[model samples]
Target: MERLTGRLVQMYGNIVSFLRKCIFYILSVGLIPNHIAFIMDGNRRYTKRLNLMQGAGHKVGYSALMSMLKYCYELGVRYVTIYAFSIDNFKRSPEEVQSLMDLMLDKIEELLREESIVNRYGIRVYFSGNLKLLNEPVRLAAERVMLATAKNSKAVLSICVAYTSTNEIVHAVRESCEEKWDEITLLNSSGGYVPDESDHLIKVTDIEKHMYMAFAPDPDIIIRTSGETRLSNFLLWQSANCYLYSPSVLWPEIGFRQFLWAILNFQRIRFYFDRKRKQL
Candidate 1:
């Protein structure tokens, strides 16, 4: 009897795996986004719904995040970014803020342990934002994971912590100014070239290069959960023409089916977009 039950369980697992592969293959035939950004919202609300202790929502949301990352990678998505936390979030009550910080630190350290998702998928991890705003312990842990996974090229995971779209733009502008200054100084000293009006002007590309997310292409699709239709200050500069998907489910409640629907929606309009681009 025991042997029969074990065999049945194995067979059931095999069936589920086969179905997952089929889903990927079907989606692959259509447009597959190279990068996807997620606004992982409704964590606290989810916790409230479940009647769990405060901060438990974040833990559940973390599990959903890992599962979604794996799904995206299997579907040939090369880049995934999540709105992990915003600078505005610091205005919350002290206990809630501390809980979030502690949760982030714990998750970062967890990524470095054995059998971590980062190692499993060879995902390179990056944290974008003013990381100096983070406490020392959290910042150090983030750096450790980033350095540890730097060589993993299979996929990229960008977590926006201590971040907001306005803050990102400001940071980029500051860096671009410094870069332009260095160029001007080099031209005047080494090349004996005098500055002109054009030399002082900064191009759009200048600021783009200095942006923290310069390494990855802009997200092709941005998803928000919990029925939130607004961008909520995410990827403002990068998402000008990106497709947006907002589902009614909470982040922790989102499953593979929600992902499937988002991809199908993207596929539906990709052809129209491509033709329009050609005309342009």
Candidate 2:
């Protein structure tokens, strides 16, 4: 009887998993998100849980990202962005930081060599952070990947390495100021008056145009794994209207199920917003 009971429990678990998949599929068909961003948290935690080396955790996380990107593209998401490394990560132990830098360089090279993957998927890759901080090899690899996939329009994949939202804002401000100066000079040459700084404060839209992600639409859903709810200074401007989803799974352990759950939750919230807008 004990053996029978064990079998029954296993069967029940399978049945529940199947039901969840079906429900997720049905819900997703009705409401698809255009853009999804991931924080890709918990690589170190996953490595610790598995008793693996620190760098192994990052390798597993990279594999997970590859799988998840394919799933997102299959689900009809046109744009995806992932937070690979933050600016603060450079403050980690020297050894660990070196490992991460090497890993990034290796991954970028691998991606560049995978021309079949690019051609099959028509996916364009872009790096949306301060690339100046990266070592020459990694920087060149990133640039190659970006150039190689620049014409692909089926999907846009953005990786944020050495990125900080605050720094991004500061950079945008400086760029806007330079553009303003140029515009003012041009206007003056044309005998048109340019507004003084006191009279023309920078508007939100002007600042947005200077941002690295200015060409891309805002993400509709943002997912963070490892149960973290904080944005950790990521995409402050683009994420203003995004739906946040925090899953308990570590980055490597997160599979299609977690993705589905995030999409379903996003759909429900989107419906709510639609109704609210209609009422308004």
Candidate 3:
């Protein structure tokens, strides 16, 4: 009976995979999103609710992220972004902050391994944010992984660490001004030219060019778990018209069903978004 049960479980898994593939095929016919962003919320809450050991929830959350990444890539979503850490999270107790950094360093190093998702999916990994805020080890690991996979063109994965939308906007604007300062001040060969009013105005393109999330197009859907509808300063500038999906399940509890429903909703409302964009 034991042997029979094990075989049945394996068979059931195979059947599920086959069915999921069919559903994806049908989903592809109607609009498949090019970019999807995730605000991985409720990790601490999940741990507290379950009475799990300290830091266990994050480990489980990482596994859930891997699964979600697989589903997105398999469904032809070329760009995926996750809010891995926020700038405000630095206010946490020193011990907790360091613990999360340790976990980040470990997972980032794993991305460089041969069998990791970055390799498996031909993903170009990007660490998008004020990476300088991270500790030396974690920052270095992130840089290494980014450089190692910079050539992969099949898809893109952007991990936002030490990030917040307000900070990103401020940083972009600062960079934009500095980049154009020289031309604004010294347009003439003799260096005696007065700055034109137009030269002082920063264009939308200039700001966007300096944004951390510039590598991928604006996300079509931003999913925040644990039934949270708020963006929490994730991607304010880029999310002008994207759909916000709030699933009731916590981060670790999220799965294929929630993901599928989110896609279905996006497809259903895609027409309205398209029309709105045309009007804009």
TM-score of each: 0.92, 0.86, 0.95
Candidate 1 residue lDDT tens string, 226-276: 999899888999987678999999999999999999999888887865675
The C-alpha stretches of model 1 lying farther than 4 A from their native spots are 1-10, 189-200, 275-280
Our model 2 lands, by Cα RMSD against the true structure, at 5.8
Per-residue CA lDDT of model 3 for 57-124, tens digit only, reads 99999999999999999899999999999999999999999999999999999999999988999999
Better of 1 and 2 by TM-score: 1
Sort every candidate by TM-score, greatest first: 3, 1, 2
| Model 2, residue 144: C-alpha shift (Å) | 0.5
Which 10 residues in a row give candidate 3 its minimum summed lDDT? 182-191
Clash count, predicted structure 1: 0
Clashes of 3: 0
C-alpha positional error of residue 224 in candidate 2 after TM-score superposition, expressed in Å: 0.3
- What residue pairs are clashing in model 1? none
Candidate No. with top TM-score = 3
Superposition error at 25 for model 2 (Å): 6.4
Task: Give the Å error, residue 53, model 2.
Answer: 1.4
Global lDDT scores for all candidate models: 0.91, 0.86, 0.94
- Misplaced by over 4 Å in model 2 are 1-28, 189-198, 274-280
